[model samples]
Target: MASKKNININLKVWRQKNAKAAGSMESYKLDNVSTDSSFLEMMDQLNEQLVAEKKEPIAFDHDCREGICGMCSMYINGRAHGPDTGITTCQLHMRMFNDGDTIFVEPWRSKAFPVIKDLVVDRSAFDRIQQAGGFVSVNTSGNTIDANTIPVPKADADKAFEAAACIGCGACVATCKNGSAMLFVGAKVSQYALLPQGKVEATERVLNMVRQMDEEGFGNCTNTGACEIECPKGISLENIARMNREYLKASLIK
Candidate 1:
């Protein structure tokens, strides 16, 4: 028999004209924000306010508001995907904040992930890294094998499936002080290296992926484990270790 009161909040958002242009924090006040609204929904409200006032609306990347796409690259209040664990920005609810809280919203901060505009960054670096080696060059074109029929150990299959859960959100890099992408790269490498179909390309896969990761300006793993902490999917440090082993084994190949 009670109605929930909507809260008012302030947003200190990063604004950039473009990747080449200068940027700054612009402030906005929002009132009566529904706690039930997801973070992206609140952002939509803010954009609507800006548009209604004839100002440039804040631009943020988001798709599958369901949190699967990992496109909501909002670094909120110094935490990737907001101050939450195991969730993306699109999954964050307004109820997480207090009535008068001032939320600092910024794009994914990394040399590789340059800012495109307010709360949006050029994460194409991830795409390039994935393209470098995130695949198996199997000749299953006409003779596709039933994956279930393939003989695979349950343990290896489990690891590969877990590794495949990575959604490539770049939170691992954003939260990292060194801006490292070890977790993301590790997951990619592990996903394939654990499977039979990908073993043939293992040596080349790890080498190419690691080389491209460095070329993309991603830093080396700091060993601080921040990536695992902020990762929305909880991709483990084991994958990073596995990748390191793969890289070492690849490098040792004369």
Candidate 2:
């Protein structure tokens, strides 16, 4: 095996003391960063350097760095999750940049997701949307039938699983020029709508979720398709179409 080379790079990081404070990009130079290091690990190194100098370290969100938590939200060099495709910020590697490259890191930007601090945005809007109607209300007090007993078409099941892959990372919203959350909401809606267990309250679920999405102040989807392209999970645009259909059916039936 060959030894991976290390590189030096410059970082431009956004810093804000609080939600009410104005923010600006701050520059820092790093030396001998390993190309094998993950982006979050590089960030840790930066923080360590700052602390050694008695300066307040950059604050960024990260947990379950394996990419499942979606807490590591970052806009790197003008792209969500750095220059990688189908990966989150924690999964981005330092090898993507060269020695002399300058990397810019910022938080997810949108009216719905206000900045809580440097590189940390409040994504609770998604939680509120989910709470609105993201589940199937089934009575579990009695004897439950085996999940396999109910027959489901293989196509619908597969699509539902794909939609369920969304991690709620907010990259779709950040990447979209309009900062629309249609892709995220669509995935949440489709995951339920495609399942037989979800059919009972399907109409109400769609209506409530869509209504909550609008109330959160997210921009409307203009169909530019940036959300689908930048999604870390590669959640298909088809889910958006499915959500639209579900919403229309719900609206008419109600």
RMSD of each: 2.0, 1.9
Candidate 2 clashing pairs, residues 3+ apart or interchain:
none
lDDT for position 80 in model 1: 94
Q: What lDDT does each candidate get?
A: 0.90, 0.92
Estimate TM-scores for all models.
Answer: 0.96, 0.97
In Å, residue 99's CA in model 1 sits off its true spot by 0.6
lDDT of 2 by residue, 21-103 (tens): 99999999998889999999999999999999999999899999998988999999999999979999989999888887899
Which prediction has the highest lDDT against the true structure? Answer: 2
lDDT of 1 by residue, 1-254 (tens): 01355989999999999989999999999988998899999999999999999999999999998878888888899999988899999999888888888999998899999998877888888888889998988676898877778799999999998889999989999999999999999999999999888898999989999999999998888699988988989899999999999999899993
* Model 2 misplaced stretches (Cα beyond 4 Å): 1-4
Segments in model 1 whose C-alpha atoms lie over 4 Å from true places: 1-4
TM-score of the candidate numbered 1?
A: 0.96
